[model samples]
Target: MARPEPEGRVRRFSTAERMVHRATGYLMLLCLASAACLYFGPLAQLVGRRHLMVTVHEWSGISLPLPSLLGLFSPAFRADLRRLNRFAVYDRQWLRAVRRRRKSPEARPAGKFNAGQKLYAGWIAGAVLVMMFTGLLMWFMGLLPFISRTSAIFVHDVLAWATTFVVLGHMRKALEDPEARLGMRTGYVNRSWAQRYHSRWLREEHVGDLSERRTVE
Candidate 1:
């Protein structure tokens, strides 16, 4: 579903993918904001609704992955997931370049997701699962006495802060890559963007498009 558009644009994210992304972002924000109100003393009093905030936090956390889960029903979404999961030799090169903080793009054979994006995706997925598990434990502490409520709180708080900083860093990078943001907004990116950071991907897309055209002919 992600292909070249008319003019000099290429599709980056499909509309469904963008919708899933936006929904998940909103849910995550709701979870964070509600959690802050429930957890912080001043915020809790200022909000004057501990019970409501707690309910919102619990339900929002539970629903955080709902959009992504529903998106898997789309075959296009599944294929995009495959691309994200398939790391290549060039991914390793890119990781090295990132560790060194190379001043320029390393001319690595990047795919739809660069190695950094893939790694971040993997991390966030794991973090979400952990948070969910710990949150459920804390929500129903009496159900599982074997699990330490204190430990769950500690892990949840730590991961919440970790997720916050990681997301902030991601946002900062997104600010630098305005085209990437546009791709998510409108499901399309400039063709030159593909050539610049993902030349290998651009070449592969061209070949695939050409083959498809021939097949159509």
Candidate 2:
């Protein structure tokens, strides 16, 4: 028998969170695109057009971190982040199930953000910090006389490569998970999706209220 479509509920991402998230995404994309062209394309000359691309890249990188910081202030995002950061005993089992492609139809469930999402969030945060430090050093090489300019360039390049790889991985994971994308898009998910991927959060947020109209699903 075909399974019925899971009923949708409300209570998803807030306007502020969504706006900040979208802004960050755009700025990150701008930074990456400009940097890539400057580093690996014939458009490198365009990078030197009044140092346009470099300036854009630097400013975008600087701006990208702000949205995430602002997101922390949102109660919804804060609550979600807390749930995501919680390290449950069953997370290991989830990892194993993921690897083996053997997650049972019935199993102990997860919260708003899974362990993988938490790890990704942590990694992106670290990457941004590292990139900012290295980028600043590159921009102001003479300010840090203790470190040679050549060494600063090397470190910046290395971190840039690392960030690129990590961001690509993040994009791949997002593409692979439709519900994950949908949650970001409409700011809600079907009850079944919430139950499967974020059961703990659903229970906490929507206790005694399963009707879709009662909450944002």
Candidate 3:
């Protein structure tokens, strides 16, 4: 069970959602930090534990999907996954508005996830899968005699850099929206924030009855 939203706020993320995000984010940070130590010669020397760093990096990347997999057991997480999968008419309108560099949350309303978010989610999901695959291949070159370890390493390195940049960009974007960060952190967001950026989602919520909702259950 959960407490009521604050008067001016509404439930945006469920507890399960926040837990999964936090778990995945922490694991990702671990992987990136270990990778930085492993990949950079100076850092590797400074860290001075090559074998330990390799072990940490390998295991962290391998565990990256576990939080998301476990989250599937949560009804709230499953519901949000469905939301992330669907793309409606308003999603297209949102993308168009984004390309034109204008804010039209009302006319080009967005649901729980806008087009850009959906794309980013899809891309990061795919990238993680690819990274896992390539990383495994690199770790066990003997497992695939036909596949070149060099090629696997190349792809892994490229994707790692791309993921780093994309993650940095994501963080920068999140910093621009304090309400969004608050929603993810505390499971509630100001009603006005939802109305401005996720008007469609706000409309779908029972705004008047938020006090009756159990946001953390």
Cα lDDT for residue 2, model 3?
A: 53
Q: What is the lDDT of candidate 3?
A: 0.89
True-vs-predicted CA distance for residue 108, candidate 3, Å: 4.3
Model 3: per-residue Cα lDDT over 1-217, one tens digit each = 4576799998988888999999998998999999999889999999998999999999999999999999998998998999999999888888888888877566568888888888888878999999999999988878888889999999999999999998888899999988899999999999988888887788777653464455533
Single out the weakest 10-residue window by summed lDDT for candidate 2.
1-10
Q: Report per-prediction Cα RMSD to one decimal.
A: 1.9, 5.7, 3.4
**What tens digits encode model 2's per-residue C-alpha lDDT throughout 1-217?**
3233336754557667677778888988898888887787667765556378888989998888888788877887777667666778766666767777775633535666666677777777787887787788878867877878788778767877887888889889889889777878867667777777677777866664555546555
Q: What are the lDDT scores of the predictions, listed in order? A: 0.86, 0.74, 0.89
Candidate 2 global TM-score: 0.81
Best by lDDT: 3
TM-score of each: 0.93, 0.81, 0.91
Error of 3 at 128 (Å): 0.7
In model 3, the Cα lDDT at residue 37 comes to 99
Backbone Cα, N, C clashes tallied per candidate: 0, 6, 0
Ranking by lDDT: 3, 1, 2
Top candidate on TM-score is 1
